[model samples]
Target: MSEIIKIDSIDNNGRGVARRDGKAIFVDGAILNETVEANIYQKKDSFEVATATRIIKESSARVTPRCPNYGVCGGCSMQHIDPSTQVAVKQRTLEDNLWHIGKVEKAKVLPPIHGPYWGYRYRARLSVRYVRKKNDVLVGFREKKGRFVVEMDTCPVLAKRVSDLIPSLRACLNNLSCREDIPQIEVAVGEETVVLALRHMVPLSDEDTQKLLDFAKKHDIVWWTQSKGLDTLKPLLTNSSDSHKLYYDIPQFGLRMFYEPSDFTQVNPFINRTLIHRALNLLEIESSDRVADLFCGLGNFTLPLATMAKEVMGFEGSETLTERAMQGAKIHGLENKVSFTTLNLFDVDKEWLENLGFFDKMLLDPPRDGAFAVCKALTEMNPSLRPKRIVYVSCNPSTLARDVDVLVNSGSYKLLSAGVINMFPHTAHVESIAAFDLVC
Candidate 1:
């Protein structure tokens, strides 16, 4: 039996922290201000892994999760913790990583940005499996710490309308003649419609096609089928009135952007708008200033920045993404103000930066790999075209801190201000935005 320790706080990964025998211990399913007896699962050189056996005392922030299969489903981790407290923990996580990892401090810690806590997931990739023993079909996210998909009848994190279709989806698949042929279902909700992209290993029979068409008509859903890669997806019905395009509207900017199901997009639309506004505000764009948006995906930030700046250049690795961005610019009547290029950012060169010309402001929204190569190339560029101000938005803190070290120590940029955005409420994933200014 592991020694019972009172959990003093929670870590960035949603684990409870406690001290046992002068050593740090991480307990799962235990929250802050909770005194619980734990069973040690594994022991490492410096720390121990445990699971709470009994909760002698519970924290005030603890709440009964809404989902029946809360712990088993991998979709949500912080559902047990209060929603307001979830934002506070993410804010502290950003501050701690900045001070501890980068050895830097922010001039100001902006208040954390938050939005709807439940039913905010507008995008999801759900797995589909056929259980031979039960002679039934199961579809949803994978189980926590397991390889099998959880048997979820409903998902509370999905939009209410989407959640309501779970049972019908299961029944629809079970009744199909190609029941075992289907592999997965991708759900994406747009401004006016919901798209279900079904992945199948074999072609659907005529009867199966009729069933799918009946289901689509009865539920008022658009059905798309994919037999091979993403490019193989096509509509099953000929007379369906659903638009093939998926789009979301940004009322604040009067912008409606269209994207494909496989394309990258902000998971939470509400928080994404807020993040774009905050990042632009921190950049302090001027009418005469030119800006560059790196790793620009579907022009999420590029289009908005173009509205305020004199000229904006967006760079993306995929030519398809650049093409979509160009289309968006044309639709918004800002094509003259914005120009997009396709370049491999991982292998950037000084000459590439030179060709792009001078920019006064920059925004970096790279993936989890971070932008080390691009950062190095920018710092090595001639001093004449170096951007004066930059705003970095990242999903990983460790990589963000490492990149900040390079920019602060080797480059001319200095960390100005940084804060967190609770884009995902119940998960351990943290999204942050930071500002840097040239220290000439």
Candidate 2:
């Protein structure tokens, strides 16, 4: 049945939420304060999922999406919503998660951090599919709610240079002798370089290599071929030169950190720099203060912390990342002040926390799974050993909420402030940061 419902607010997944017979109904492609005609497809005892058939009333926050494949492509969901309103919705989602799931109240809500709505994604893993029937190569993200690749001519969310290279990349791959063997491309854009790491199931022939070389020379990109795994990725058309190097700099801290194309780096460099600045500010690091950056990938936060603190120690699960972090420290002339160690943060226990010693401040930037183990370990530690302040940068709200609950309720910490960061604009991915202080 077609039901007309008023969208009261947006859910965390960028779906419009309404109520039908006291049960919450989620409608896709609807906006807040708008009345949408939706067809309920999946009905549960407590809620229903629907797709909006038509909009009887449109919201003022609705805007025309720039990408033609907005709804069809699974890369972005909130493209139809205005940038400011998108951030607002994300902030609300963060707040709701903290309150409802974490059972913690923040004294203040930090204003959402946002940047360019388009062309902000610096890194992306794109799928490659050679459609036999279509006699064409498909290179882009997956189709909405399906495993099929979305045949995209351009992707505006990627760096403009990379976005413009999609059609040419598709053509180059299609022309390759082993086109069917190529399955994926990892696009990484640095401050001064662009790298495309192509994953191949079979060895490239001499002709395929030459084609890749020609494409690299034509487009001015460094190509890497991965035969098996990330460790197998090697330079295709370029040597170990400045042109092939991938690095981003923090002029404010006089630091430039380098990493391999497969290393974990923030998708949005603009928001990343801002997040580092905000984290440092919240840390209030003194010249004599020692800081610990857990789950620190390639010293994204450690090197900057070292700039103001006496000593900074970064710990990560991957030894490769730790090695890169140490190299970053050395390049920035912080080798003596910053140290990197390999530790499985997800498997952290109270004994491990005790062995790490004390720090004046701590910063943790974990993946979408969050840092539940470390928080639990912190809760078990003595009050005096706990860091004075803790800043957590999280990519998932649900996991962030669960970890925050452990910190505030059980770890004897107070949630001073928390807010959302729009790292992936036009998408439902919620990147957020929170500050916690030891309860007196």
Candidate 3:
């Protein structure tokens, strides 16, 4: 049975929200403020999930999706909406989260930061499978709401080089004896080179290695084989110097960062640069200021802060990342100005926070979980130990909202400004930055 419902808004996952019998129905492929004919697929206690069978009335913000696989591919959800309006939706989502979840109003809304909508994903993990029934190898992201991979010849979201190689990759994998053994491919793009790490459950034969080398030479793709874990990854084609390392540069700060393929780096390099610039501007750093960067991965923000401030302390829970950050600092000749420390910010308390010494400012770039423990510690610290200004970069808005609530309600801080960064355009993921000022 088909039912018509008016989409009231969109959810965090980009699904449209509609009310039916006092229950919230999440409809796939429906735009906000538009009426859709949907067929319910799954029913839950409080809400039901449906797929829009037909668009009875379309939204003014709706636009034709560029990718043919947009509806089925799990890579993107908001591609159907206009690129500019997509950022608007994300901004509204962030504001709504702050007001509803944090129970506080933002003193100022910073303009959204955005970049290209296509070919912006420099990092991606694609699923691979040899389908005997289809007599071909499928390589791409998974289908929407399915375990099977979406068979795509190209991905518009990926860099043109990576996207253009999808078919060739499938052909190469199909010819390999260990095709069935390969389960995943990690794509990491740098300014000068692209690396593809193939995860194989079984070891590749000598003949397979030669075939990979040939493919590498032919397509100019750096091939890496991972038999077990990330640590086991090695270049299939020896003497591939480009595959030995990957790095990006912050030209504004004259800094370069090198990282291993498996390390965590932002998928969008343009947004990352802009994000760093915005964060530094908001921190109001001075030459005499001593800044701490919590959860700093690979010295993304720490290195830049070190260049601007007298001394910067970078703390991360992962010892591997801390070591990498230190190396980056040394490479940039900022080792004396910046220090990397292995500390678990998640488990921080008043004693640990106070022991870390004083800082004039802080930059926190935590994972989706947010820095609740650290924020709580900040609230409990003596006024003298607290940093005057804090800039937080969050990947998840709900967690950010929750943490900001604690910061404002308990930490004696005021929410100065907040805004969204379109880090992953055409997706519902919102990367945001917020500034907080300590109350005197």
Query: Of the pair 2 and 3, which is ahead by TM-score?
Result: 3
Question: Can you give the lDDT of residue 206 in candidate 2?
Answer: 96
Report the lDDT tens digits of candidate 2 across residue range 311-363.
99999999999998998888778999999989788998988878878888999
lDDT per residue (tens digit) for residues 1-440 in model 1: 66677999899878799986788899888999899889998898889989888788999998899998888888888898998888788888877877888777565888888999888899998899888898889989998879888998888889877889999999999998788888799888888788888999998888998888899889988888899997887776646557455898877778889887777888899899899899999999998989999999899999999989999999999888999999999999999999999988888877888788889999999998888887777777887888899899999887888788777777567899888888888998899999999875
Q: Which ten residues in a row have the lowest lDDT in candidate 2?
A: 236-245
Local lDDT at 189 for model 1: 88
Candidate 3's residue-wise lDDT over 1-440, tens digit each? 57889999888778889887789999988988999999998899999999999999999988899998989998899988887878888898899989889988756999999898899999999999999999899999999889989989999999999999999999999999999989999999988778899899998899998988898889877887789877798777667676656889999999889987788999999999999999999999999999999999999999999998999999999898999999999988998999988977899898888988899999999999999999998999887999999999999999999999999988489999999999999999998999999985
Whose lDDT is greatest here?
3
> What C-alpha lDDT values do all the predictions have?
0.87, 0.90, 0.91
Off by over 4 Å in 2: 238-244
Candidate 3 total steric clashes: 0
Global local distance difference test of model 2:
0.90
Residue 75's C-alpha lDDT in candidate 2? Answer: 95
Give the C-alpha miss distance for residue 46 in model 3, angstroms. Answer: 2.3
List runs of model 1 lying over 4 Å from the truth. Answer: 1-3, 238-241
